[model samples]
Target: MKQDIDIPKVEGVYVAIVNEYNDIYKTQDWNAYIINDNDDALEMVIIVTDGYSEDKITSKFRKKIDVLPKKSYAKIELMQEELFAVNNQFKVTYFKGNTMYDKVYTFRKNTINLKALQPVPLMEARGVLVK
Candidate 1:
Protein backbone atom coordinates (compact mmCIF):
# COMPACT_ATOMS: atom_id res chain seq x y z
CA MET A 1 0.00 0.00 0.00
CA LYS A 2 1.22 3.50 -0.78
CA GLN A 3 0.26 4.78 2.65
CA ASP A 4 2.27 2.08 4.39
CA ILE A 5 5.38 2.97 2.45
CA ASP A 6 5.00 6.66 3.26
CA ILE A 7 4.65 6.04 6.97
CA PRO A 8 8.31 5.03 7.35
CA LYS A 9 9.48 8.38 6.03
CA VAL A 10 7.83 10.47 8.72
CA GLU A 11 9.63 9.13 11.75
CA GLY A 12 11.76 11.19 14.16
CA VAL A 13 15.45 10.94 15.05
CA TYR A 14 17.55 11.01 18.26
CA VAL A 15 20.67 13.03 19.13
CA ALA A 16 22.90 13.18 22.22
CA ILE A 17 24.82 15.77 24.26
CA VAL A 18 27.04 15.92 27.34
CA ASN A 19 26.61 18.51 30.05
CA GLU A 20 29.37 20.23 32.00
CA TYR A 21 29.48 17.43 34.55
CA ASN A 22 30.27 14.88 31.82
CA ASP A 23 26.69 13.77 31.98
CA ILE A 24 24.77 13.16 28.77
CA TYR A 25 21.45 14.69 27.74
CA LYS A 26 19.10 13.54 25.00
CA THR A 27 16.64 15.66 23.04
CA GLN A 28 12.97 15.01 22.43
CA ASP A 29 11.68 13.00 19.47
CA TRP A 30 12.93 15.19 16.65
CA ASN A 31 10.27 14.84 13.99
CA ALA A 32 11.21 15.97 10.51
CA TYR A 33 8.21 18.26 10.39
CA ILE A 34 8.88 19.63 13.86
CA ILE A 35 12.58 20.40 13.34
CA ASN A 36 11.57 23.24 11.04
CA ASP A 37 9.67 25.06 13.76
CA ASN A 38 12.26 26.07 16.34
CA ASP A 39 15.11 28.50 15.67
CA ASP A 40 16.21 29.52 19.14
CA ALA A 41 16.85 25.93 20.13
CA LEU A 42 20.31 24.45 19.66
CA GLU A 43 20.64 23.04 16.18
CA MET A 44 24.14 21.64 16.47
CA VAL A 45 25.99 20.05 19.41
CA ILE A 46 29.69 19.47 19.91
CA ILE A 47 30.84 15.89 20.29
CA VAL A 48 33.39 16.29 23.08
CA THR A 49 35.72 13.36 22.78
CA ASP A 50 37.92 12.12 25.61
CA GLY A 51 40.98 13.50 23.78
CA TYR A 52 39.72 17.10 23.32
CA SER A 53 37.39 17.32 26.30
CA GLU A 54 39.94 18.71 28.71
CA ASP A 55 41.06 21.77 26.78
CA LYS A 56 38.06 23.13 24.83
CA ILE A 57 35.56 21.70 27.29
CA THR A 58 35.27 22.49 30.95
CA SER A 59 34.07 20.52 33.92
CA LYS A 60 31.76 23.41 34.78
CA PHE A 61 29.45 24.74 32.07
CA ARG A 62 31.93 27.32 30.86
CA LYS A 63 29.97 28.95 28.02
CA LYS A 64 30.84 26.14 25.61
CA ILE A 65 29.22 26.27 22.18
CA ASP A 66 27.63 22.92 21.52
CA VAL A 67 28.46 21.13 18.26
CA LEU A 68 26.10 19.48 15.84
CA PRO A 69 27.29 19.77 12.22
CA LYS A 70 29.36 22.37 10.36
CA LYS A 71 30.23 23.79 6.96
CA SER A 72 33.31 22.43 5.23
CA TYR A 73 35.17 25.73 5.68
CA ALA A 74 33.97 28.46 8.01
CA LYS A 75 35.29 30.28 11.05
CA ILE A 76 32.13 31.96 12.39
CA GLU A 77 28.45 31.18 12.16
CA LEU A 78 25.23 32.35 13.80
CA MET A 79 23.41 30.09 16.24
CA GLN A 80 20.23 31.06 18.06
CA GLU A 81 21.03 34.55 16.74
CA GLU A 82 24.03 34.75 19.08
CA LEU A 83 27.58 35.42 17.87
CA PHE A 84 29.35 32.42 19.36
CA ALA A 85 33.12 32.34 19.35
CA VAL A 86 34.31 29.55 17.05
CA ASN A 87 37.50 29.13 19.05
CA ASN A 88 35.95 28.16 22.37
CA GLN A 89 32.98 26.33 20.87
CA PHE A 90 33.62 24.07 17.90
CA LYS A 91 29.95 23.67 16.96
CA VAL A 92 28.42 25.54 14.01
CA THR A 93 24.90 26.80 13.21
CA TYR A 94 23.08 27.82 10.05
CA PHE A 95 23.33 31.29 8.53
CA LYS A 96 19.93 31.48 6.82
CA GLY A 97 16.49 31.43 8.39
CA ASN A 98 14.52 30.28 5.34
CA THR A 99 17.10 28.00 3.78
CA MET A 100 18.06 24.89 5.73
CA TYR A 101 20.67 23.11 3.62
CA ASP A 102 23.61 23.71 5.94
CA LYS A 103 25.25 21.11 8.19
CA VAL A 104 22.81 21.92 10.97
CA TYR A 105 19.78 20.72 9.01
CA THR A 106 21.50 17.65 7.56
CA PHE A 107 21.84 16.09 10.97
CA ARG A 108 18.22 17.00 11.70
CA LYS A 109 16.84 15.41 8.55
CA ASN A 110 18.51 12.05 9.10
CA THR A 111 15.97 9.35 9.85
CA ILE A 112 18.03 8.14 12.79
CA ASN A 113 20.05 11.06 14.10
CA LEU A 114 22.64 10.78 16.87
CA LYS A 115 23.37 14.48 17.24
CA ALA A 116 20.05 15.22 18.91
CA LEU A 117 20.32 12.51 21.52
CA GLN A 118 22.06 13.19 24.85
CA PRO A 119 23.40 10.33 26.97
CA VAL A 120 23.41 11.39 30.62
CA PRO A 121 23.91 9.63 33.89
CA LEU A 122 20.74 7.77 34.82
CA MET A 123 20.54 9.24 38.30
CA GLU A 124 21.09 12.83 37.19
CA ALA A 125 19.16 12.55 33.93
CA ARG A 126 15.84 11.64 35.52
CA GLY A 127 13.05 14.16 35.13
CA VAL A 128 11.02 15.83 37.87
CA LEU A 129 7.73 17.31 36.79
CA VAL A 130 6.92 20.70 38.31
CA LYS A 131 3.28 20.71 37.39
Candidate 2:
Protein backbone atom coordinates (compact mmCIF):
# COMPACT_ATOMS: atom_id res chain seq x y z
CA MET A 1 0.00 0.00 0.00
CA LYS A 2 1.25 3.43 -0.90
CA GLN A 3 0.94 6.16 1.65
CA ASP A 4 1.14 9.89 1.12
CA ILE A 5 3.04 12.29 3.35
CA ASP A 6 3.07 16.06 3.56
CA ILE A 7 6.38 17.57 2.71
CA PRO A 8 6.73 21.07 4.02
CA LYS A 9 8.29 23.78 1.90
CA VAL A 10 10.88 24.83 4.38
CA GLU A 11 13.13 27.86 4.12
CA GLY A 12 15.55 28.79 6.85
CA VAL A 13 18.44 27.36 8.77
CA TYR A 14 18.26 23.77 9.98
CA VAL A 15 20.80 22.56 12.51
CA ALA A 16 21.90 19.05 13.40
CA ILE A 17 24.64 17.19 15.19
CA VAL A 18 25.78 14.12 13.26
CA ASN A 19 27.80 11.35 14.84
CA GLU A 20 30.36 9.27 13.03
CA TYR A 21 29.28 5.87 11.83
CA ASN A 22 30.80 2.91 13.63
CA ASP A 23 31.56 1.15 10.39
CA ILE A 24 33.95 3.90 9.40
CA TYR A 25 36.69 5.64 11.29
CA LYS A 26 35.54 6.37 14.81
CA THR A 27 35.93 10.09 15.24
CA GLN A 28 34.18 12.88 17.02
CA ASP A 29 30.80 14.00 15.81
CA TRP A 30 30.23 17.34 14.13
CA ASN A 31 27.48 19.93 13.77
CA ALA A 32 26.00 20.88 10.44
CA TYR A 33 23.64 23.71 9.70
CA ILE A 34 21.74 24.31 6.49
CA ILE A 35 22.02 28.05 6.24
CA ASN A 36 20.08 28.57 3.04
CA ASP A 37 18.36 26.65 0.32
CA ASN A 38 17.46 27.90 -3.15
CA ASP A 39 17.15 26.76 -6.74
CA ASP A 40 20.70 27.75 -7.47
CA ALA A 41 22.65 26.39 -4.53
CA LEU A 42 22.61 25.31 -0.91
CA GLU A 43 24.73 26.98 1.68
CA MET A 44 25.80 25.19 4.83
CA VAL A 45 28.18 25.51 7.74
CA ILE A 46 29.89 22.55 9.41
CA ILE A 47 31.52 22.65 12.81
CA VAL A 48 33.87 20.03 14.06
CA THR A 49 33.11 19.68 17.72
CA ASP A 50 35.85 17.22 18.58
CA GLY A 51 38.09 14.28 17.54
CA TYR A 52 39.99 16.34 15.01
CA SER A 53 43.51 17.57 15.53
CA GLU A 54 42.58 21.22 15.17
CA ASP A 55 39.60 20.91 17.47
CA LYS A 56 41.43 19.09 20.24
CA ILE A 57 43.32 22.03 21.70
CA THR A 58 42.08 25.33 23.05
CA SER A 59 43.56 28.82 23.09
CA LYS A 60 43.03 29.34 26.82
CA PHE A 61 43.63 26.46 29.15
CA ARG A 62 40.81 25.64 31.59
CA LYS A 63 38.65 28.25 29.94
CA LYS A 64 35.74 28.07 27.53
CA ILE A 65 36.34 29.07 23.97
CA ASP A 66 34.27 29.55 20.84
CA VAL A 67 35.28 28.51 17.35
CA LEU A 68 33.96 29.50 13.96
CA PRO A 69 32.51 26.94 11.62
CA LYS A 70 33.42 26.28 8.00
CA LYS A 71 31.13 27.39 5.21
CA SER A 72 30.30 25.21 2.22
CA TYR A 73 28.19 25.75 -0.86
CA ALA A 74 27.01 23.09 -3.26
CA LYS A 75 25.68 23.99 -6.67
CA ILE A 76 22.56 22.46 -8.17
CA GLU A 77 24.49 20.76 -10.94
CA LEU A 78 26.53 18.84 -8.42
CA MET A 79 23.52 17.82 -6.42
CA GLN A 80 20.24 16.02 -6.80
CA GLU A 81 17.37 17.29 -4.75
CA GLU A 82 14.55 14.91 -3.85
CA LEU A 83 11.48 15.36 -1.78
CA PHE A 84 9.73 12.19 -0.72
CA ALA A 85 6.04 12.53 -0.17
CA VAL A 86 5.84 9.17 1.49
CA ASN A 87 8.09 10.01 4.41
CA ASN A 88 8.62 13.72 4.03
CA GLN A 89 12.29 13.19 3.34
CA PHE A 90 14.43 15.82 1.68
CA LYS A 91 17.73 14.75 0.20
CA VAL A 92 20.65 16.40 -1.55
CA THR A 93 23.52 14.79 -3.42
CA TYR A 94 27.07 15.74 -4.21
CA PHE A 95 30.15 14.07 -5.64
CA LYS A 96 33.60 13.33 -4.35
CA GLY A 97 36.29 11.71 -6.43
CA ASN A 98 33.78 10.62 -9.08
CA THR A 99 31.59 8.97 -6.43
CA MET A 100 28.17 10.40 -5.65
CA TYR A 101 26.53 10.57 -2.25
CA ASP A 102 23.27 11.71 -0.67
CA LYS A 103 22.45 13.21 2.70
CA VAL A 104 18.88 13.11 3.94
CA TYR A 105 17.60 15.93 6.11
CA THR A 106 14.05 15.68 7.34
CA PHE A 107 11.90 17.43 9.88
CA ARG A 108 9.57 15.52 12.14
CA LYS A 109 7.75 16.56 15.28
CA ASN A 110 9.65 19.86 15.29
CA THR A 111 12.99 18.06 15.18
CA ILE A 112 15.41 17.67 12.30
CA ASN A 113 17.19 14.39 11.66
CA LEU A 114 19.97 14.52 9.14
CA LYS A 115 21.89 11.48 7.95
CA ALA A 116 24.79 11.17 5.61
CA LEU A 117 24.23 8.25 3.23
CA GLN A 118 26.73 5.48 2.62
CA PRO A 119 30.23 6.16 1.42
CA VAL A 120 30.69 8.48 4.31
CA PRO A 121 34.18 9.42 3.25
CA LEU A 122 32.97 11.27 0.19
CA MET A 123 30.40 13.17 2.17
CA GLU A 124 32.82 14.32 4.83
CA ALA A 125 35.69 14.92 2.44
CA ARG A 126 33.75 16.56 -0.37
CA GLY A 127 30.08 17.26 0.08
CA VAL A 128 29.82 19.11 3.37
CA LEU A 129 33.50 19.89 3.56
CA VAL A 130 33.77 21.43 0.14
CA LYS A 131 33.89 25.17 0.01
> Which candidate tops TM-score?
2
Kindly report which residue stretches of model 2 are placed more than 4 angstroms away from their true locations once superposed: 1-70, 74-88, 112-131
- With candidate 2 superimposed using the best TM-score fit, by how many Å does residue 116's alpha carbon deviate from the native? 21
**Models, CA RMSD each:** 17.2, 16.8
Model 1 agreement with the true structure over 17-110: per-residue lDDT tens digits:
2212222444242211112122233343322211122234322121223332322211122121111111222222232323322222222112
**In candidate 1, residue 104 scores what lDDT?**
23
**Judged by lDDT against the true structure, how good is candidate 1?**
0.23
Give model 2's TM-score versus the native structure. Answer: 0.22
**Top model by lDDT, which number?**
2
